[model samples]
Target: MSIENVKNVAVIGAGSMGHQIAMLSALGGFETVLQDINEKALEKAIDMLEQRMNDWVNKGKLSEEQRRLAFQKLRTTTEIKEAAQDADLVIEAVVEKLDVKREVFKLLDQYAPSHTILASNSSSIVNSKIATVTNRPEKILNMHFFFPPLVMDCVEVVKSEETSDESVQIAMDFCKKIGRTGVLLEKEIYGFIANRLLFALSNEAVYLYENGYADFKDIDLIAKKALGHPMGPFELMDLSGIDVGYYANMELYKETQDPKDRPAKCVEEKVKAGELGRKTGKGWYDYRKEVISR
Candidate 1:
């Protein structure tokens, strides 16, 4: 399971994280495939990737030849079996549902090669549980990449009780090959590493906002400036999409079955009203015609 032996990588989701993963794999010189059930989403991922790669070249972060190579290595498709067949590594980044993941892993076990490293980008679901439905539990682990994997440098290599030393080493090596700093976690925790800490602060922020502790902007401002973080919890939540934070809050609460972990009503209410943050052009703050922060 050497990193050098991994020639192809298949990312089984076309959303933000999956698209980012595919781009990184291509940039790292692996044949990368992005597959999704939604054809439109797959197309969007490819187009956005092309634009981002061009941007990298313009910024002198990547050579034109390297950019062309990355584009050549990237592929998009809708067929799971086709994508899994020759992939040396298959990462599942689908919706964060245990049963849906179980179904996908079961199929992956049947279609993907025996030596393929099956990983989930799930931030919270237990890897051991997802692995239970697959044939090679040791080959299945959580390779949790941060949002926008192309930029952020940390990869969480989550190991379950069933994870083999070889499997863990392989994952860490792959992360390094892609120019990412890797952290090894002994057991599967609720939110892996980044998201767990993020959501902890996020939940508190929601509590503050709903209780009228401060104005929305103030809550966001202090978290960014005073706390010395890149973005405040609300701003981060907005950038990540409010619905994402809402679902994460709900999932965390269910995982712990604790009221303390429960999300505030204000968050759910916002999600219900379709104020889904950056993607939707309205979250903690509103957006204009441009999709980027000002």
Candidate 2:
């Protein structure tokens, strides 16, 4: 299907990335449905989108009328069928697990229109793994958005071996229509492009910290001051969630079975303690005491 023909969009899972993708779809004039198994998460997603729209109005980036229209285009539901029934495009943004993603795609394939393009927002797990469980592998591709989809400009469009060229173009066009720069990958890889570079740096950073070379904060300082990075590895982990990075590393390790690909001891410990970064009020930094207290 062509981008122009895709009038309805379904975003499965209403976590951080899913909600933002749904908001962008609504902003792009598509009738968008945001779906999650948890009603509370869906409610939170709607609240966040409304707050963001209000912020845009306050900043004069969006008119009140435009904001109202965007909300009109957005709908929330807990029912998977209700969300995917007539959707021309379905974006799965569930947790980073291959089995879970495959299950989501299987349901999507059952409910979504036959011509609907199925895309995943997975950062490390490729779409091909999920596509194999569905009947329409040709329609499946990866449309991996950044951490915050509304703010990020670049989206990685990954084509599996079974993904059709037409489906790839439609996915690219959809990204452009939603005001994101689409970087197309002809073949699927473990981390795509950006995540591969990011994980490599983070792995080394964790090694340095564990080996007692320097404190995480000092390392973060060096990355910001010396490398001109906006945030240090620890800071970025706090913002993005230590659990997220840890799971991504585990996914890579499952694929490669390399000892170097294992999750860092620090990451595993933080996750075990439920200190999952800003969302949990703690991670590499303690947020409960002070805002991002390093």
Model 2 CA RMSD to the hidden true structure, in angstroms: 1.9
Locate the minimum summed-lDDT window of 10 residues in model 2. Answer: 285-294
Cα lDDT of model 2 by residue, 78-136, tens digit: 99999999999999999888888988888999998899999999998888888888899
Cα error, candidate 1, residue 84 (Å): 0.5
Candidate 1 lDDT over residue span 168-277, tens digit each: 89889988888998899998777877887887788788778888899878987898789888888888878777776667667777777988877688888888999988
Determine the backbone clash count of candidate 1. 1
> RMSD of candidate 1 to the true fold?
1.6
> Which ranges in model 2 have alpha carbons more than 4 Å from their true place?
289-294
TM-scores for all candidates?
A: 0.95, 0.97
Pairing residues by index, what is the TM-score of model 2? Answer: 0.97
